[model samples]
Target: MTRKEEVFERVEKSILDFDGDKAVEVAKEAINSGVEPVEVIERGVRKALETVGKKYETGELFIIHLAAAGEAANRAINEVLKPEIEKKGEEIHFTGKVLIGTVAGDIHEIGKTIVSAMLLASGFEVTDLGKDVPIETFVREVKEQNPDILGMSALLSTTIPVQKDVIEALQKEGLRDKVKVMVGGAPVTQEWAEEIGADAYGVDAVDAMKKARKLVGA
Candidate 1:
């Protein structure tokens, strides 16, 4: 196999092993060996996460381990991608910008973090508003940033309603149609997103990135 493929395999293994630092090292090796940033993410890291998720589904890997794999893969890509992102900046320009947040009354952030990483990998600049974000924060950020997409994540059933509230707030400000909106999390579904007037609903981070790209025409 090629050196780039070898580095990718190593990074994939490191993520499955939950070794964030080592995964980053392996990604750097891939970069030094001439792999593209997008390639590292769409190929190496995702391949690792797919395996992790399959193992999780089979009960061979626990939730904690699955979370760790996501974290590790993200960390590795973050390191391996910085230079290429900069290079791409000078070439294609960024396709879109994003503002991401976890809704109010919910403190979960891991999933949102993963989505943010995936968006970054796809060349969308993201501003993370973090956990327990209120509608006001979403509105304010959208006003200030005028991003192409706004992504809301709610892991709790209780907080899922807040995602709609944010959309309503956007409409009230005459900004709802100015930006594309997306919703996701454990309790979120495509039907819910459609009912709430969101542009898309993603079941996972990878899907989120794809939908975001489409929403922004990027």
Candidate 2:
């Protein structure tokens, strides 16, 4: 096989093996070997997470496995791939900006963190507001940051209503149409997103990235 193919496989394998250190090593090696940052990310790290997601869906992998892979992928992209791109005199321009937070009453952050990493890797500027964020904070940030997209996540059925409240708050402030709204979490559904007037519902981190891209026409 070609050198590029070999390096790609090596990086991909490191993530699949859930070895964060090795993934970082391989990512740097790929960069030094003239592999493009985007190639290493899309072909290696993202592909590995996609597999991990599938394995989780099939019950072949536990939450720990997915978490480990997510951590490794985040390291590979942020610590290695992104720097390489910047070193190449690229400005790391983002196609869009997103403001994300976990709605009030729900403290779940794993999903939100992963989605932030993935969006960052995919070249979106993300401002994370942390977990159990108040609806007023969302409205405040939306108005202040003027982000291209606003993402709300909730891990509880009760907290899901907070997403609606935030949207309503945006509409009341006349800022609803200025940005696209995306919602997701374990209990969040596409119907719920629509019912809450969200422009998109991300089923997972990857889906969130895709929907964000579509939202910004990227």
Candidate 3:
């Protein structure tokens, strides 16, 4: 097999084995061997996560297994992939710009943070607005940053309506169609996403990254 393919196999194995150190080691090796950082992430890390997702769906793996893989993938992407991408001179550009935050009255951030890291690893420029962000804040940032996607998270059922509020604010400001909106969290559903006029709903971080890529045509 080619060197890149060999390294990719190692990466895939490391992640499946939940070996963060090995994943990082092989990822660095892949970069040192002149593999593109995005290539390593997309072909190696993402493929592993896709398997993890399938395992979760099939009841072959628990939440802990998925979290372990996600953590290992994040570490490899940050310590190995991102650094290499930055070393590529000035020719590199982000896959897209994404603004993410937890909606108003929601003090939860774990899900949002995970989604942000996944997007960043996937080569998207991300701006995290943190938790308890007001609807006006979301609207203002959308107008200011002009990001390709705006992702909102709400862990509480009560705060879920804040997503609709933000969307309405966007429409009132004439910016609803300017950016794609993605909504999710523990309580979010595909029905709610469609009801609120969101462009997409991600069930997890990996799904969010995939949807973000599609939104940007990457």
TM-score of each: 0.62, 0.64, 0.64
Model 3 local distance difference test score: 0.86
How well does candidate 3 score on lDDT at residue 155? Answer: 97
| Whole-model Cα lDDT of every candidate shown, in order | 0.81, 0.85, 0.86
In Å, residue 167's CA in model 1 sits off its true spot by: 1.0
Model 3, 1-218: lDDT tens per residue? Answer: 98888888899899999899999999988987888887888788888877877786688986667767867886887787877777775233568989999999999998998788667556676788999999999999999989999999999989999999999999999999999999999999999999999999999987998999998999
Which candidate order results from sorting by lDDT in descending order? Answer: 3, 2, 1
Task: Compare candidates 1 and 2 on lDDT and give the better one.
Answer: 2
Prediction-by-prediction clash tally: 0, 0, 0
TM value for model 3: 0.64
- lDDT accuracy of residue 133 in candidate 1: 95
Clashes of 2: 0
Model 1, position 20, has a per-residue lDDT of: 88
What's the lDDT for candidate 2? Answer: 0.85
| RMSD (CA, angstroms), candidate 2 | 4.8
Give the per-residue lDDT digits (tens) of candidate 2, residues 1-218: 98988888888899889898999999988887888988887777766777777786688986677667767776887788878877787644456889999999999988998788667555566778999999899999998989999999999887889999999999999999999999999999999999989999999987998899999999
